[model samples]
Target: MAAAPRWRERLFALYFLSHIPITLLIDLQPLLPAGLQPPALTELLQWYAASFRDPLMLQPPEWFKTFVYCEAFLQLPFFPVAFYAFLKGGCKWIRTPAIIYSTHVATTLLPILAHILCHDFSKAELGGPRTQRERLLLLSVYLPYLLIPLLLLFTMLCNPHYSHTEKRKRK
Candidate 1:
C-alpha cells in the first residue's frame, strides 16, 4: 500500500469535518437571516431527506433570479478552473484561490453568522420552514458552491503524478 501525502490527509480531514456543522446549519436554517437563508444550503438537506443522491434545482422563487444570475454570471465554473491551474498547475497559486474562496465563504455566510452572533432572530429568519419541494430546490441551487471547493481541496492533496503505491515503494 502507498503512503498518503500529508497535505491530502489534512485537506480531506478538514473537508470531512466541515460537513458536520454545515449539515447542522441546514437543520437550523430557520434561524438564519432573511437576506441569506443559508444560500445553497437548503438544497443539500432536502436532497438527503428525499433520498436523492444528487440534488437537482427544482422550482425556485422568482426573487431568487438574482442569485441564479449572479452565481451563473460571476462565480461558477471559473473559481475551480482557476484554482485547478494554481493547485495542480505548479508554482504558488494556492494563495489566490485560498483568499478568493475564503472571501466567498465569508460573504456567503456573513448574513447568517452576523444574525446569530448579533442575536437578531427577526433579522435571521429567512422565511419559514423548508417544504419537501423547497428543500430539493434549494439543494440544486446551492450544490455548485458546496461541491466545487471540495474538488479544489481534494485535488490539492492528491498528486496523480505520484502514485500512492509508488510513494510507498520509494519510502
Candidate 2:
C-alpha cells in the first residue's frame, strides 16, 4: 500500500521526459509540413532516414516498411500517454497503455530479430548490417525499443495503484 520510492518516481519522470522529444521528432515530425519544421529538425530527419547507408535508410523490405507504418500510427499516440503516466508516478490509466506498448514492442521486435538471425545476408534486398560493429551499431537504436516497453510494463505491474481498485483496498 506504500507509494513507490522517490527515486523510482524520479526515474520514471526522467524517462517520460526523454520520450517526449523522441515521439515528436522521430515518430510525429515526418507527418508535418517541412515549412512547419525547424531546419535543424529537418536535417536531423534526413540524416536519420538516409545516413550511414543504413538498411532502414536505403530500400528496406516490404515487411520493414509495414512495421514502420504500424509503429508510426499505433505507437506514436502512446508516447504522450506513457509520458504522462510516468510523470505522475503511478496511475490506473497507465495499465492499458503500458500493456499495449509492451505488446507492440514485443511483437515488432521479435520478427525483426528473427529475420536478422535467419536471413542470408548475401541475398538481402536492402543489404542488411554487414560487419559485427555495423550490426551492433544498428541494434543500439532498436534495443531500447525492446527494453523501454518491458521496463514500463514492469514498473506498471509494481505500482501499488496500477489498478484503481487497489486504492480502495488499501483503505
Q: List RMSD in Å for every model shown.
A: 12.8, 4.3
Query: Which candidate tops TM-score?
Result: 2
Q: Write the per-residue lDDT of candidate 2 for residues 72-152, one digit (tens) a residue.
A: 777666666766766776466668777777877778888776665455566666566666666666667767777766766
Off by over 4 Å in 1: 1-65, 86-90, 112-171
Counted clashes in each candidate structure: 5, 0
Off by over 4 Å in 2: 5-17, 27-46, 49-53, 123-126, 159-171
RMSD of 2: 4.3
Q: What digit string (tens of lDDT, one per residue) describes model 1 on residues 1-171?
A: 333344654553454344445434553343344546555676655655345322112333343334444444454444444435443434234535544654564455443223223332232223322355544453454454445455544454454432233335563
Best candidate per lDDT, number? 2
Q: Where does the lowest 10-residue lDDT sum fall in candidate 2?
A: 49-58
